[model samples]
Target: MADEEEPKTAFVDESAVPSAQASGEENGSLGNSWSEVSDMRQGLHQRHVQMISIAGTIGTGLFLGSGTSLARAGPVGALLGYTIIGAIVCNVVLAVGEMGALLPLSGGIVRYTETFVDPALSFAIGWNQVYSGCKSTFCDKSGKAATLIQWWITINNAVWIVVFGSVMTVSTLLFVRVYGEMEFFFATLKICLIIIVNVTALVVVCGGGPNGVATGFTYWRNPGPFVQYLGIEGALGRFLGFWTTFSNAAYAYAGSDSIVVAAAETRNPRQTIPHAAKRVFARVAIFYIITIFFVGLLVPSDNEQLLSASGTAASPFVIGANIARIPVLPSVINAIVITSAWSSGNAGMLNNSRYLFGMAKHGHAPKIFLRLNRFGVPYCAVLLITLFMSLAFMSLSKGAATVFTWLQSLVSIGALITWTTISVTYLRFYYGCKAQGIDRNELPWKSPFQPYAIWASLFFLVLIMLTSGYKVFLHDHWATESFISSYINIPIFLVLYLSYKFINRTNIIPLSEIPIRPLLEHAQRFPEPPEEPKQGWKKLNIFWN
Candidate 1:
């Protein structure tokens, strides 16, 4: 008050001030100077980046959870459920690609939110993702009680979380050079495994292998093509059941946004992000849909293996393997499912670290997180995220399977919120671009249908949220406590938003002063060619270059 605190300004002059230098001026006396921090090394090639994105989205959910979804909705219901969800997911990818191709920063959704939406929105999404990722390990659901087999399964999952987390953490700490190579190898291995399973299934379907047979489409008719549980109560029961099944299916597709998190690490994000986004949608839809399609045709949804009273590995995939009389395939698929969970957790850790970093940069987190290690890794932030994740693993002590289901519910809410925000942000981005007189054609990647796509996506997201919580209001047989817990994410987000507003004493900015133009321009930094080669033979001959 002595000097009458210099009037706070919303807009800074980029031309007059350097970003690195301005860090100190903007936030006085911050410990580390941004200028001294070396730029991150570009290590991930386009191919590796794309595949990692692909692997991140396609996880154990499809391999394992699809069976549960198929059982709940039958073949036609499952197909329709995923189709609708897939459309929404694709729209999200498009919207995300539009923003990411421009920004291509490591901060991902958090960064985008900060730029286009309110700072509070950014904080909410970042914190929610961080919380979600840290708690993911406790969600595995393959264990029993007392029996040696059950004890082994529980111990196995626990060991997996620690070992996988440590390995991924150490690998991430290495120079980007090593990290990129390892991720590429891991992603390729996983992809190869998927192809093997798919091809094996195809061969079996076409009467190629030992247990071969053209098993026509008899299974569908055998099961009567649908499994109706809603009774003939009316449209209400049917509607509630549809929502319940859709929510379950959406959980299977929850990690689709993991690709967006890798934007910062990729070499040429503008060129690579769109390709990766497209591949994510295509792979998820085709892989999951076709696999389930075959499963429906091969094994009835009501088959004992597909609808085991116990929800362990007794899913349709496992059942299909057993039905085909394939030796060792069931075990192989189980192992791959575990690895898929590990990969998903690994990606989650990476994502949370960046989200933490973004929050710190935006003044919502401690300044310590903004400091980078010599390798340009945000070591403090990574360590913090890991610690949180480790603590989250404590939920496993309660019960891994139960914990996983709860976590999945939270994941559904988080994903829905994030997707909806992406759409809203895109709408703002579009109008800002137009108002700024920016040429959409000149942008490296433009989302098709503009405002319409954004609006449509937003509409679907709202529908999902409402439908997701519908069971709580209508189903007397369902546990009220469980229903409330499942829908808690909605209230949690509201509380977070309101608390942030109270703390900051802030009001929504007027539409005219929203600062969307600058944000849109900032996001457009993608598509620019890198100043140097990232890897391969070109990297090895740097001296000659």
Candidate 2:
């Protein structure tokens, strides 16, 4: 008698598996191929998932870019701006958690789109995310082409792209499981750095410096707080400055949703995802609000130090530290920024690989991406995404500042699109649940305020996107060639969507027929673990021994 085939989930779709297998062989070695990979091995620990999510959101952008926002908006303006953006980020997180918890599949937003909207929409979202991740990586310090070749051969931005991409690819291949652990350590390091900076600034403001002096919030009073540039008369310049600052604040919060990329690797994703999602608001509130508030209090917004935008070393925190006569703090902070850059780059590469893997699994990309190494890593996808991320180095060759600005704009636009999709997906999900008569109480985690929260997030994101491009419409003098290039990413997205639709002959489905119910039902089966118990003295023994 023939041996019985092993049991597999009906969802695996064996017919689809053949294409992926064929593609795997043609591309390259699948790496670590093994039969009978266990689900537990595939799943990441809850701690890793939660920490990675937090690390993903707190990037070099926050450390290096917040200073620019402070300069654009006075203390008060910057505070208010971040608060508003935080609210929007909170709403987006809730919406994502709702859909993510309901369908804990690796497809993430793409899967949500497929279930709540159309296949084409899913394809577009996944591919766009992949493209955005790759594009954004160029700004990573290690990935800069000029820096890479400066020590050796002279090459253009193209060479930097390939070089950085190869490095990321190798890194991803060498350490898949350790990525989460590394993120956890990096997050801790960043958190410590912020704490030190905040404490030092507070000390300086409270007369703890060598001279026992205080700035006394004089910066706000002198500038009269605001830079109204567009006004025919009074405070209009201040308002425009505030707007520019707010845009920077929003950009700082851009990649918060990166946590979703690791959904596949998360253990008990339903619980882990919801728990992680709930933290977004608190994280933003504490981190952004408190940090900005203290900075405003310690260093006046108009200080010459604050106005400098030279590099990461010229960060407002560093500038404020130097002015306050703090010894060695600036150098320490600079070192932290370098580490933060690496952490952010690592997270970016990880996310891009997952996005590619999800696309391949769904047939939106080549099947080779679906192949996993014995370590259960998507090695092929990781290699390709790393390759593309190196393209970010091209900015260094062309001009670092120009490349950074344009890429930053693209990142903002990509995030806006993603947030919009999340809201719309949730709206459809809400009604789909109702029509199917599924009780809300049965959900593992339900978003509060129902459809209102979803709509509110959508509204805010649209407003940001419009306002982001507002400079182009309002002031002729404000128009720069770089400003125009910033908006190019939006058109790129539209063209990609239209071209895919035309080629695939895809049509949007009616809201009634959305496949949300089935996906939700399938997801509901895998419940999350209860919160981990608080550590006791005995718990420390495992590490000590």
Candidate 3:
């Protein structure tokens, strides 16, 4: 979030951008005025950012959380839910990617929200990210660490929580490149695992399993596609099922924004950010939609194991393997699932620290959080975030893990809110650019469909976010905790937004006053690198490369 403020001397003088700088000089200097907010090094290579995106996104929400979605929505509902949400996520990626590639700042989303929309909005979203990132890591680490550790013997999950927490904390404190490399390695592993699961699902569907049964769409036929919800019966119930699964889809796509956040630390972000953002749609299609499709084919939505309390049997891959009577595959898949959880926790730490650092850099948070170590790590923010990892210890208490699960539901809500904010920010940015007489074609990246895509996505996302737990409000379908976790963030977000606005009396930047000209000139000064030449097997590596 915050980094060592690069000296203003590093910036170009008035002689550099003579026209725009001189114009702004009368009001406020642009290039000389703005770049001082944050100064993180660009140590993340193209590979690092690509894999970081993969690692952040393809995590537990896909590996294990899909089970509940399958059970609640049935196969068709689950698939449609994820597909629709994935599309919305792609739109968000494009919006953020366009802005991020041009600006490429640390905490790009939060910073953009502040600059284009409202500072109060940015402040609320920034701290929401911090709190969401910190609180959610605990239950995630505790549960997954327990699963992996207990493979050997029955032991307290608290022990494993401490172990994994220390490892992640230490790893995060390492140099930025080291952290990038570590994530790249883990991300590749997760990618490989997803491929293996997809392949295995294909085999299982084709009767390659020990059962010698060609599963095909038998489960979908039997379950009859849409799942009825809350005994409401018929189409409305099915629709509710689909709507409920949106939150699960949200959880799966949580980390897509991490790419935008990491722009400051990314190499050739003007080129890399857009390139990576363009690839998001393909990755979601192949990695998530395809996997979910096969998952629907291989595992029945009604399978009791789909809701396993320990989260082991609930993994559709595990269910498929067991159904096929495949030897050792279940255990291996479970192991991979464990690692994915840890990877998510690690990714969260990295993203949230940057978010906090961004807040501090922008003066929305304490300056102490701006402290950076020799390696350019936000030491204070990292230390504080790590301290919150101890919240996982609460899982040791009876029923507390369940409570934690309910609380963790808020993570998906936070993600939806974050995405909505991004879309709104992008709309403001698009209009602001038009208002300033800037040509969209001159930008580093131009997202397709303009404000329409963002508006449609934002509207539906708000609809989903508001009704994510709609069933809890139904008659005799009530759970107080569920209702709270699902909708409480809405009012809380408003409170944060309004409180900040009321306190600061912050007004949205006028289109005429928005520093679009200097920002465009700044981008013009640094043209993106030429496209790299590719050949032979290297060209084929485009799937991951």
Best by lDDT: 3
Residue pairs with backbone atoms closer than 3 Å in model 3 (clashes): 1-354, 1-357, 1-358, 2-357, 2-358
Residue range 274-360, candidate 3, lDDT tens digits:
878888887899889999999999888888888776656667888888888899988888887787788888888888888887777
TM-scores for every predicted model: 0.83, 0.84, 0.93
Query: In model 1, which residue pairs have backbone atoms overlapping below 3 Å?
Result: 102-523, 103-523, 139-404
Displacement of residue 95 (Cα, Å) in model 2 is: 1.0
Arrange candidates, best TM-score first: 3, 2, 1
Q: Candidate 3 at 17: error in angstroms?
A: 10
Candidate 1 Cα misplacement greater than 4 A, ranges: 1-13, 16-38, 137-157, 207-209, 230-241, 306-312, 389-400, 507-527, 530-545
Taking the tens digit of each residue's C-alpha lDDT, what string does model 1 give over 65-99? 67766676667667777777778887888888878
Backbone clashes, each candidate: 3, 13, 5
Worst 10 residues of 3 by lDDT: 1-10
TM-score of candidate 3 relative to the true fold: 0.93
Give the alpha carbon lDDT tens digit for every residue of 1-545 in model 2: 01111221233222222221123422211111112222213345566666666555575467767766676677888888888888888888887887777665565787677556655677778877887766766454444323423323455546655654555566666435577667778777887887888787777777887668876676667664654444424577677777666467666776687656666556567778887887776678767778887777766666665544245433677777777877787777776666676677777777777777766655678988877765667788887875565455455553666666667777777777877877877887888778777777777688778788778778877877767866666656566765665566666667776777787666565655555544455455534446666576857631111
